[model samples]
Target: MAETAVAAVLAELAALEDPKVRAVNEKQGNDHGVNLTKLRALAKQLKTQPELARELWATGESAARLLSTLICRPKAFERDELDAMLRQARTPKVHDWLLTNVVKKNPHAEELRLAWLADADPVVASAGWALTADRVAKKPEGLDLPGLLDVIEAEMKHAPDRLQWEMNSCLAQMGITHPEHRARALAIGERLEVLKDYPTPPNCTSPYAPVWINEMVRRQAAE
Candidate 1:
């Protein structure tokens, strides 16, 4: 009965694919053609089903994995299960969705954050940085702000694309949240110049750390 349901869900996801969108998604290292809004709608219709989510994720289909993250019960996942899922989440979209939707809400988030930060794989480490950046922005009382700045200054420039983006975010968040560290964060950003030349659309903010930091800080001061 469960196998039949999983097969039905996979077929539904397959039917949603668009060649043009899949081409675009492929460029970003994702293999799916499903629009996120449509995927969310599907998830809402399916509702939360942990076992079904696990089965969908095991199918190794990017679209199904994305839908799984949307419908899974975050807290139901064991720490080891989340760890295994992170390792298997190879594509950028799946990796990001799993981190944002599932891992962030897991009970063992901090422990996993530290463990994954020290992970040898940059993609996995990026997830760690993502988790750390969340804390830097929200619950930063005990975190080592200066030390984080130190690492970003030293390693971010040499990091891979995925890791570099996450580290840059952490640096920007650090600057945005802590007035004391803002100038140093700005200086490091200026020195590194990572993503400085990134082609950002006119209305959208650039991902370049210096510009992102300044823009956010400016907004905070105004409000």
Candidate 2:
């Protein structure tokens, strides 16, 4: 019965697959692509079905795994299971989704963040940094903002692409949320010069830390 239900979900996912999106996903290093809207709709239908989610995740298809991230119960994941999933994340999209939908909500989020931040795997470190970024964006009351800025200043230039991106995100969040750190964050941004040359689309915010900090500060002032 469980197998049948899992097959039905997979069949729905397959039916919703878009070749164009799949091609783009492939270029972006994802192994599969289904319409994300459709996938989310299916996940909504299967909400809280951790057993079914496990089955979908076990199939190892990218879309199914993406759906599983939504349907799986955060509390159902053991640290080891989450660790294994982080280790096996093969693409940035999957890793990002897992961090946002699964790991961030999990009971083990703090533990995982601390452990994975020191992990040798770039993907794991990326997820850890992402989790830290999320925390910085929200309840950053007790976090060592100065120490964080120090680390970003020291390591961001030599970090891997994924880790660098998350570090930049964390830096931006810190600058936006903590007024005392704003000048220091901008200074660090200026010093690191990461993504300084990356192009921004018209009317879009630049990702360079100083520019990003300025834009966010502007928005905050307006609000």
Candidate 3:
């Protein structure tokens, strides 16, 4: 019964074109919206039927995105599942989740996530930096610390002023906290010197930035 439903849902989702899925994905609410509801239902279905997740993942990027969200949420994904999900994920959404969670879970994800540095899309490239910050916190060896710095620095060169400011904030967290690597992060800041006179960083008004900065600083210092 569950398998039938999973197949139908996947089939329906598979019929969606990339442009259509990208359009809907762009509108994804920060709070998950209806997608969260479907994610929960599928999670339950997958519990008794783990194969459903594989089926959903095999469908396409849309299903992969949906699965990545569910796989990151509580009471659903465990360490091993996260491992597997990152191991197989190939979509941008999956890349985002992998960037967001994998480093904290395992050091091996760095190599995979760093490859996104060359991705043509800035969003994916930014996500790669975000993942670099994640792995840097763990102080994992053999990871591309300098390469990550290069990407962030390069991003400030032609990136929009708004994104440049965001990189500044990431710099503060990555540089100020990781003393050993603080110089690398500061190099990124130097590359974004255009931001120094902006009064406040472009997007610092958001409530989340200060809190995130504070926490990241604290964690980096602790590391």
Candidate 4:
């Protein structure tokens, strides 16, 4: 029964694939070509079906996994299950969507945050830093903000692209959300100059930390 349902969902996802969409996704490191808006619409239709979600995720196809994150009960997953899923999420979109929709909301979030942060795989470690950035922005009661800066200052420049981007996000979030570390964050962003020349579309904030920090700060002051 489960295999038949999983195959049906996979067929639906396969039917939605478009060569043009895949081309764009390929440039962004996403392997699947399904439109995200449509994917979300499908997820909405599926609602919260944990059994179906597990079936979809087990398919190991990127689009199926992305949909799995949507319908799965985040809290239903075991810590080890989440860890295995993270390891299986090698593609960018699936990995990111899983973190955004499932892992971040799981009760084991903080525990996994600490564990994944120290993972030897830079990809896994990037998820840890992404969670830390969320904490820095929202629930940073016990985090060592200064120590995080210390790590970013020492490691960000040489880290792999995936890990470095998350580290940069943590730095930006710290500067934007915590005034105490704002100056230090800006200084580090200046010195490292990571993403300094990243091509940002007009009116979009640059990922270059100094510019991103200042833009967000300016918006906050305005509000």
Candidate 5:
């Protein structure tokens, strides 16, 4: 059933040259969100047309998700091919997609770990940390605790209020999800005083504001 749906969607996509417009239409059909059900179906039919799937994803608003779905499909994408496509994506959404799909969950997880850690963009950097935390949850042994520490510290130094706040959430996630790492995270959080340095803005979840900051602290402390 999923294969049939994917084939039908691909056939429809092939008949049209502009997938961006199709993407808009698809989004509208799905109440202004990525059609994940359709994408998951497409992922099931990943063989024999990986490149075309990648092309369609490149033009879709839900490209990130599709890319992630594709990455999760075993044997669908070559390592170098995936890396090249990720590098070619210039949009922040695409970058985020790559972070979620390829960098974070790639079969070649170690390679992506190093690459994303070195990325200069805050969006990329934050996503990198997020992925690191996620992967650590799955496989805690031999994890790069030092690298994770470096990223949160860097976030405090270079990231904006919003990202700084996100770092707090990520840390709390790490703390709760991986208890062994909790102490290290709390130690860093206490000494950094990043929340004090940068205040949260109106209508923003900045790390400096009393409400969000306190919430983050509480979450971190939660048993």
Candidate 6:
């Protein structure tokens, strides 16, 4: 029955695949060309089917892996399995989805986060930074905010692209949530000058750290 379900889901995904989108997806390092909107709709159809999700994930197709993240039960995965999955993530989008939808919801998240942050693998490190940013945005009660600021100040410019984006996000979160850190965050942003010259779409918040911090602070004050 699970095999049949997996086959049906795979068929549906294949039916929704677009060659043009697939070409673009390949460029972005995704292995499949299924439209994300269609994938989400398909995931809804296969909701909460961990057995089916497991089978789909084993197939190693990008869209299948994405659907697996959506349908798999967080508690059903062991630590080693999650680690293996993280190690297999090859693209930024997949890494983001796996961390946000799968790893962060799992009970082993904190332990994984701590270990992955120091991991030599760039993908794992990206997941760790993403998870940390999520935590900093939400609970943040026990986190060492000052230490985080220090790390960002010291290493952000030198960090890999994916890790740097999340680290910068963590810095922005600190400035947004802890008013006391705003000045220091701004100062750190100034010193690092990370994303300083990146062009932002009109009316979009600039990802440049100082501009990001100021915009977030202004929005918070109005709220």
lDDT computed for candidate 3: 0.52
lDDT of 1 by residue, 1-223 (tens): 2899999998998888899999989988888999889899999999999899999999998899999998899999989999999999989899989999999898989999999999999999999999999999999988989999989999999999999999999999988888899899999999999999999989998999889988988887899
Q: Which stretches of candidate 2 lie over 4 Å from their true place?
A: none
* Clash count per candidate: 0, 0, 0, 0, 1, 0
Writing each residue's lDDT as its tens digit, candidate 6 over 47-128 gives 7888888888898888888898999998878899999999887876777788889888899999899889899976678788
Clashing pairs in 3: none
Give the whole-model CA lDDT for all candidates, comma-separated: 0.93, 0.86, 0.52, 0.94, 0.55, 0.85
Q: Score every model by TM-score.
A: 0.97, 0.94, 0.51, 0.98, 0.54, 0.92
Q: How accurate is candidate 5 locally (lDDT)?
A: 0.55
Which scores better on lDDT, 1 or 4? Answer: 4
* Candidate 2 residue lDDT tens string, 68-175: 899888888999999998887778777888888888888999999999889898767888888888899897767787888888889999998889999999998888
Tens digits of per-residue lDDT for model 4, 182-213: 99999999999999999999989999999999
* Model 1: number of backbone collisions: 0
Give per-residue lDDT, candidate 5, residue 51.
Answer: 44
**Minimal lDDT window, size 10, model 2:** 139-148
Compare candidates 4 and 6 on TM-score and give the better one. Answer: 4
lDDT of 3 by residue, 20-58 (tens): 445566654221222534555654555544355555556
Please say which candidate is ahead in TM-score: 1 or 2.
1
Query: Candidate 5 residues 118-201, lDDT tens each?
Result: 677655455555566566656657876667667676656457643465566566556656656667766777777666555445
lDDT of 6: 0.85
